[model samples]
Target: MDLHARLKTYLQNNPEAVGKVVDYNAGTDRLFPLDLTAANTELTTAIIADTQAFSNWVSDKLRANNCRYGIGGYMEHRTIYAVSSHFDTEDEPRRLHLGIDIWSDAGTPVYAPLAGKVHSFQDNNNQGDYGPAIILQHDLNGLALYSLYGHLSRQSLDGLSVGMSVHKNQQIATLGNNQENGQWPPHLHFQLMFDMEGNYGDYPGVCKYSEKEKYRKNIPDPGLLLGF
Candidate 1:
């Protein structure tokens, strides 16, 4: 089987952690899918101007929707990337996002969806970085898969070691605010990776528009795991 099939098979085979992620239960939580692309000009214009505005916009959306979280942007070509030089390069410019972003208030607790040992973590402090992030390595039927939790509060990494074990639904971290979480609205950037490509502490959560096919295979739709 190809990597996508293998991942889907493994995840389906072990279906315990589907709703265990942050406030994304299909039945209970009022979750709304957010659009952050250029086509969402009203929202983009309101948020892209500044981080505070971004935070306010997120809060307003959540409140108006009566939702605990606004989640979307998997492989989404977002205009919000312009706020940071981290995505800007002389080359293709990383606009294609590769993960599902769960927009919520700062300090919202993030739970580990599956049991695994911490593979790696670091404070990727930059304009558009992960901030304090954690990655876990899970072996499901001998399939080595990884889950990355990004834009976490600094305290999340406290006493956290590379080899520490995290159980399913474990409270691993909380959402970081704008100042520390790469200057965007407070949210959790959750991603799945079949392979890390020899990178540590961080992986490409966003890629260039031209490399969609290559990444599409490597990064499956997170909705498969989030269960909503």
Candidate 2:
């Protein structure tokens, strides 16, 4: 099915799964505007200065509480230059982020948003990669779709099987830290995939700027399901 059709199908089938929200990159009110331009000036001083330490501190807090809080906003901009070089294909520049990153602490409890079976998972261990991950298949009102939870702790997949059953809000896994997870700050990379296209335990979370149209057609905005 087409991207829009797949989204409509998911919404129509799984009303309960919709409207659940998670924030991205939460922090105290003191860190408002996290303006990039202003931050550039201070970049020369230290690598682990304010911004780096701040992300680290936030990760620790979120992981300890097993919760996340940030502005649950959508990707308003189309041309994202982030993580482009990570891909092997020359089209990396066209790739866009197909997921909504819930920037929270490591070890936070990641619950199943809806009842589903464990479709697949993997430990995509690499820099800027999804560490241990889980993909759940939800069949709501006969509309089948998948949700991916990335950057999870290794223990999260301890007893998981391909067809393992997971109920809504069930504690499935905890957020992972950079040590075991992909070598990056702590965060949950949540994405929705309509067609697996024969890929398992790994999929394209990032795409190039030039391939936005094609990806947008294949991967709908995740906020449609996350409800933010």
Q: Which candidate achieves the best TM-score against the true structure? A: 1
lDDT of 1 by residue, 8-75 (tens): 88778768654377756567789878888878877865457688987888899889999989889888
The 10 consecutive residues of candidate 1 with the worst lDDT sum are 17-26
- Report how far off residue 178 is in candidate 2 (Å): 1.2
lDDT of 2 by residue, 14-108 (tens): 58665343332334321111112223453232332334564665545545555544322233332322432455564444234567776666776
Q: How many residue pairs clash per model?
A: 0, 15
> With candidate 2 superimposed using the best TM-score fit, by how many Å does residue 18's alpha carbon deviate from the native?
4.5
C-alpha lDDT of residue 22 in model 1: 78
Q: Stretches of candidate 2 above 4 Å error? A: 1-6, 9-14, 17-54, 57-68, 71-85, 88-95
**Total clashes for model 2:** 15
- The C-alpha local distance difference test score for the whole of candidate 1 amounts to 0.85
